[model samples]
Target: MSGLVVHSARKVDADGLVDDFWFVADDGVIIATGTGIGWHAAAQGPGRDVVDAGGHWLTPGFIDLHCHGGGGHPFDDGPEEMLEALATHRAHGTTRSLVSHVANPLASLRESLSIVADLVAVDPLILGSHLEGPFLAPSRRGAHDGAFLRDPGPEMVEELIGAARGTMRVATIAPELPNALESIGVLIEAGVVVSVGHTDADYDQAARAFEVGARMLGHAFNAMNGIHHRAPGPIIAAFENPDVTLELIVDGLHVHPKVAKLAFTAAPGRVALVTDAMAAAGAHDGDYRLGGLNVTVRDGLAVLSGTSTIAGSTLTQDVALRNAVTLVGLDPVHAVAALTHTPAHALGEDHRLGRLHAGYAADAVILDHDWTVRRVFADGVPSADPHCTPARFRMRYSFCQAGLFAYAYR
Candidate 1:
């Protein structure tokens, strides 16, 4: 009979926007949602706690489809470090995440995947593991170690799949690799959502991967071919595929604001905002490691130790949401959808993970009218205040077709 009910709020989800919204959840699943004072009757049971949103921005908790680590702990380190990283993102309203692993030795990757599988078995918040390397193109390896770079050979793919033990939800493969077209089919057959990235694939080559069931484009415009008049490349191929989702990192360091806005216009509901964060995310900037490579994070920009090669990121989903509205000129409702529903769809988990409808998870991120995360509720349990503070918190306003967008930094 115990339940958590939130009433009188501005809610945005699959239904777009609903003012004076209310939803009641019991045993970690939403049982009903309505408008005005409708939640009163549903929340009459014992052990009920009601909160007045007062018309603040309330949306579903973010789902990070691609994230390495945070809170000064790398997902590749071990189970404890992975849990710590999970905690860090959860505080920032990422209720669910996939453990992303960079290129590493097969043994190391297997161990990490095993650890992730163990955690996913017990933690519903852990979506599963994502293989971002070992099957990548060496020429566009970005921040991954080159030594472990290899083609998506069937034997290697089978081994990693075995290591993940049914917990492998997503992987990025370069379409230009030998046997990659067939590998994409194999991965899809194994229930893994395949993405084409870290590739030197041309437009046709990328199209071939999608033809074989590649459902996502990994961190579009980063570590992949750019849009050339003659060579449209994988990004264009992804844009053409209606079923594909494009992952974007809008931390201001990885992409230009204008280009990011183009993604929204081109793909609409298909763009998923992923942090692609390393350990420095939600933690102090300094030295960190992604696999065996040394990374230096200064001013929130993470790069390789001795070169200008961009590393992962120091971004959380909340900051990405704000940047989407303010910097990228996206509607607040659309931006929230990218953080919640789109990513969940990418993993085929939207049935229960995304949206604020009945039978969905009781996870919600309550934000102030200014779009700042005031609190987060996951599994019917509330969180402490969001530990999200970027280096600068200036209020910058940008007028676009989406109206006046406000940013936390200039």
Candidate 2:
């Protein structure tokens, strides 16, 4: 790839935000960064490709650890659909993401994991798979299928982990379930991030899960119990644990602006702003399905059929950033960190994925003053490939059948 010199932009770095800064990158890695008066002159050398941002905001590419689908495609299907779903997110400034799959049958979940593993090999931006179900509380199952919920047995966890081939970045489970603490230990040992979610786990049970290595509170305060004056609930338990990272969906519907602000103050830098979006995220409000569960999207909020329970969100990282700053009243630097650095750390990729530093992956998003995506670069090059399409095909072919009949028949 040719050297890229980005000029005339405000740069948000790991330390803080800077103005009148310039960046130089090659082979998808940041090579140099400088600020102030003569930076524009220094960036005008020959043989260097330049991107004049025209005074846009330049920050590290957004990293989303939990997202289902977007652009009318869901991740519960296959690679074609997964890539399609991811493209919509990329256009919205999510440069890297873990394809989050809802609870499904064991066979389907395994197939999705294998498909995501293959995609990761070809696409560096496809970080991995996050199994968000099949081991959650029935009462707070959210959009997951209640029939598929189960205890996290060692054998079952091993099977899912094996399918991921070490690409299983996170597994959300209820700490109150049988063998849940033990499963947390097993998942942690296998390099999987254990998150406590969709549970009725009180403070004591939640604390024990954290002790056993659960490091995340998935969508804190949504699928779990509320904070009682006396009980304190799982959210409080998670906040007290310094090792834990809290995933907060900053969309005004999933979480109130004040609640989101409280999370930032309570957890500080430990909060990760995730989309937790479903298929209708980048699409218009309409009917959609999540993991075979019927959902209705109205006024940009998704709700399960016949219930007030929120299915997922239609939020994007850009909106999450905007809400953090405009609604939640957080500093742009801390808000950016929640969307970038904090989420990267939660996925155990802080060393590479987050921040605009040398040696980090050349994944970044350029946003206008309104925080809309103007340009996105992945792996040191603009993703101008037309094949980077959204997942819209709702085929019924399973991966096993697709491998047998589709390839063979073709």
Candidate 3:
């Protein structure tokens, strides 16, 4: 494609926000970004479409590292469902995501991996697969099928890894399981990011997992132990480990805002805001299935039929960003980073997927003054239909420069 110029917006970079700026992108790569009227005047050229931001916020596109499903579809269903779920998220500003699947039978897991691998071959927006279970602690396997939970033994781990065919980006496991440490070694060696989650592991065990090459905390504090004076728990261990990136579900129901603020303050840029959203994320309140488990969505909250335990969130990345700023008291810049750059870094795709830097894909979300999505662009093309409406297109771009195009329009 040809170059496009986004002018007259308040630009936000990795460092901070700037005003009176213009950004240029050509063939899906950001070519130039500068502030002041001179840059805007210099940017005028033939065949360059200019989008006026009207002084609204301009940041990088959001990324989600841990999301199960959306748009009334679950990831465990198959490629069609996975694609449908991803489309729901993409309309809400998530340009790239890792297809997360819950615990299931080995054959089912293999099939899911194969489907994801095939999708990745043609869709770069599907970062990879996030195996969220089958190697987790049953006691803490919140929404995952406990019947399928198993120890991450060498053979089973190798089998699952091989099934991914090098397309698996992350796997969540309990650190205290048998051979879990060894499995971490194997997974890290295979270039997969290991995340500590769904476990009864205390401080020491969680710390050991981090020491053993686990670099992420899945939905921190939801499926794990809490912080205590003596124990400190996995949350503290994650906070203390600078290399670890903590995932937080900021839907106000999954976690208290005060606690979420504490996590943001404790981890700083290491916090990655994610939507552990299930099948009912973008749908109306009704019956749904998550990982073969019956779930009911009432009052926009997804829960087990008879229990208060949150099955998943009815959230999208745009709402997560709004909550991060308004509810969690996070700065807009850091909030955007948590939703975009941090998760991209976690998946080891920062070079091509996150931020608005040159050579990155032209995936973007345009928002209004109130942070509502107005327009969404995936792979340098505007999404055919967006999920929400805003006053105007404020600047927010999420790019995945690879060959895959997997964004959805509501």
TM-score of each: 0.93, 0.92, 0.92
- Cα-based lDDT at residue 258, candidate 2: 90
Q: Decide which is better by lDDT, 1 or 2.
A: 1
**lDDT of each prediction vs. the true structure?**
0.88, 0.84, 0.82
Clashing pairs in 1: none
Candidate 1 local distance difference test against the native? 0.88
Arranged by lDDT with the best first, the candidates are: 1, 2, 3
lDDT digits (tens) for residues 1-410 of candidate 2: 76677777887745698887777887788877777554455456666677887888988889898899988878887676676688788877888999998999999999999888866765678889999999999999989999988888988999999999889999999989998888888899999999999999999999989988899999988999989999899999988998899999999888889988888888889999999999998888888889989999889989998878899999889889888889999998998999889988887789987888778887777888877778877777764222244333212223454353121100
Error of 3 at 113 (Å): 0.8
Between candidates 2 and 3, the lDDT winner: 2
lDDT (0-100) at residue 141 of candidate 2?
94
Candidate 2 regions with alpha-carbon error over 4 angstroms: 37-47, 384-410
Q: For residues 1-410, what per-residue lDDT tens digits would candidate 1 score against the true structure?
A: 35899999999986699999999999989999999888888778788878889899999999999999988988899776786787778888898899999999999999888877877766677889999988999999999999988878777888899999999999999988889988887788899999898999999999988988999999999999999999999999999999999999999999998999999899999999999999999898899999999999999999999899999999999999999989999988899999899999989888998799999999999988878888788888775465553212212333357442333222
Stretch of 10 with least lDDT, candidate 2: 401-410
Query: Which wins on TM-score, candidate 2 or candidate 3?
Result: 2
